[model samples]
Target: MNSRYVGYLFCGLAMIGVGSTVVVSKAIAAGLPPFSATALRFAIAFPVFIVVMRVRRVRWPRLSRRDAWLAIAQAGAGSVGYTVFLISGMKLASAADAGVIAGTLPAVSAAVAMLALGERPAPALIGAIALATTGVLACTIHFDQLSSSRGAGAFTGNALVFAAVVCEALFILLNRKLSRPVDALPLSALMSGIGLAVAIVPACFERPWTLPFDANALLGVVYYALVPTVAGFVLWYAGAARVSGAEAGLMTALVPVSAVALAALVLHEPVTSSQLAGVACVLAAVWLATFGRRLRAPSTAG
Candidate 1:
């Protein structure tokens, strides 16, 4: 029983949770305002995380002043901020479009890595960025004969999702800066708490009871809270313990793929040719950007 193999299994399971988030989040938002929905999701998940930490007897990380601010800022951008944009965008766009748009995240993160971390990218990486951009444009533009309000809303929603990706990318970059890093589980719990705090005031302001409360809404919110945040984080960090960063990056492909399939099946969203093309290009870009170094062949002996 190799630990690394177990890590892979954990990570694979986590990827499924990440993939289904778009459809589930969209469903949750349908019955609640974006702020209220995000607040509810994090609020519900945060206490569960506290319980898990306590039950596991996890040693909490003592944070320095800088680390405290880091947790707050990171939680804002990555957790609360990203969720807000995502739910709002999903309300406007089809789940399938949101799913496809998510594939571009790796490309965004790679660009951030180069700029913020001073990593010099190879030619393939540049090509990957270009291809990703082109793909994004293709999916976003509605050049088809049919022009309607739905098309316009989809465009706006997709753009907002892209913005959410940038916030997430920035959070990733900032997370790299912690000289005294905490263990993933405790850190995640802390971050979730921070997210709850950030969302509370806004959630209070948002008109409650705008959406008719029902059993389905309750189910949707519960699923969003437990499945994606709790289970996904646990599995992802566990797998990350065994997997190389490269392999972890490669695994991200599953999110978009699973998202699209789930959106189509669960939400009954149609997948268009342009979106398929965009997904392909974005996947290719991610592969090239992530693995471009290893893919270079060694020089032959003279």
Candidate 2:
């Protein structure tokens, strides 16, 4: 199998993992507060990541003083900042809207890569960005129903979710610059360890520990920890190692589509016509961004 194909597959799976997280977190939020839920999710996953690193015989690298702090900062922004903003956004906005807004992470990442890292995007990618932006607007900007509370809240939440996406994008861009002298597993473990500490302090104020005791809540926490936090990150980083950051970012579009679909089915959330249109646009953009080059390539002279 081609490495790029494998990278796509891994990234697609990671998106699904990410998509499921919104629903799972929402369910848990019913019983626990948002920050508490976020904290526990990482706390459980942190140990599991550490165990995996040990099993893989991955060793941590000796970082320069500066690199060590940078790694910590990356973890803080990606894991800590992302969770805080996402959970808060979900509280303020519908899960569907949050999911859709989170889809912008690829565009955010592409912009950061261009401005900070001197990476350039192809024309196809630019078209995809336009398509995605249109889709997001179509999905979110319902002029006919502007006065409704749900509609207004969804728009606000989408904005915060976009903010969270930017933080996540910045994390990926920063991590790309870090010299990876350590094994991926151990490095991930260290980052997650730092993230756990960062999350704990704020989580205490939110008091997620007192969430209503129930089977659904337990399952939600377990699923979040195992699937999204641990497995998703591992697959994502593995795919990132083999693919371009733009390619990886494009795959994240699946997260919103999957989340909306799953929410309609499991949570009984309504799937409106406008939302469907938005999904189509975003999908089209993702396809162009990811594969347009191959379709436009000139035939070999041979």
Candidate 3:
């Protein structure tokens, strides 16, 4: 297989892993404080990473000061910041609102690439971003239920969710900017440690030990650590290394699609026509992003 094709598979699988865990996130959030949940996630994942490293005889790569800071910043922005802002934002926003905002990630990441990384997006990439955002809106927002009146809390929640999106975009962009690309496993281990370190402070404030905990949520946290935190991180970085920032950004369209599919299967939820349409749109976006060069050939011809 071509490395690019393998990268696409890895990226798709990583997003699916992340999307499948959304329901688990809801369960964990219901049962535990956000900070504590975030901390526990990393704490559980870190050891597994270490054990795997030992088993594989993979020594941690020594890093320069710049690379060290980049790793820490990636951990902060993507792991801690994204989780904290998302949980905090969801508290005040409707799921629909959050979903719409979260769906903007493709566009956000592309914009970051253009502004910060000096890369111009091709037309296909732009179309993919637009379609992905539209798909998310279609999946999440039921126009009939939309209220004419808005509350300040709703606005705040939406802003926070948008902040989470920005953090995530920055995370993707920063990965592309690494002075030296860290291998996915070691990077995952390093990030898990940094995430735990940063999140533990807020977890302490949550006083998780003093509170009663739900067993199901605890189980959910462990699953989250193993699947989304551990496996997702490795697959994501590995794929991102093989693709451009815009292409990686485009892959995120699969997240909501994966989430909706998992919801239908695991939660036994009815699949709405809108959701089906949204899924189609997302699929189209992915096809456009990956194989739409033919669509571009005529336009670029002199």
Q: Against the hidden reference, what TM-scores do the models get?
A: 0.91, 0.84, 0.78
Full ranking by lDDT: 1, 2, 3
Alpha carbon deviation, residue 62, candidate 1 (Å)? 1.8
Candidate 2 Cα lDDT to native = 0.77
Better of 1 and 2 by lDDT: 1
TM-score, prediction 3? 0.78
Whole-model Cα lDDT per candidate? 0.81, 0.77, 0.76
Tell me which residue pairs clash in candidate 2. Answer: none
Clashing pairs in 1: none
Clashes of each: 0, 0, 0
Model 2 lowest lDDT segment of ten: 29-38
Candidate 3 residue-wise lDDT at 197: 99
Question: Each prediction's Cα RMSD?
Answer: 2.3, 3.6, 4.3
User: What is the lDDT, from 0 to 100, of the residue 225 in candidate 2?
Assistant: 82
How displaced is residue 161 in candidate 3, in Å? 5.1
The sequence of per-residue lDDT tens digits that candidate 1 reaches over residues 131-151 is: 788778777887662278777
- C-alpha-based local distance difference test score of model 1: 0.81
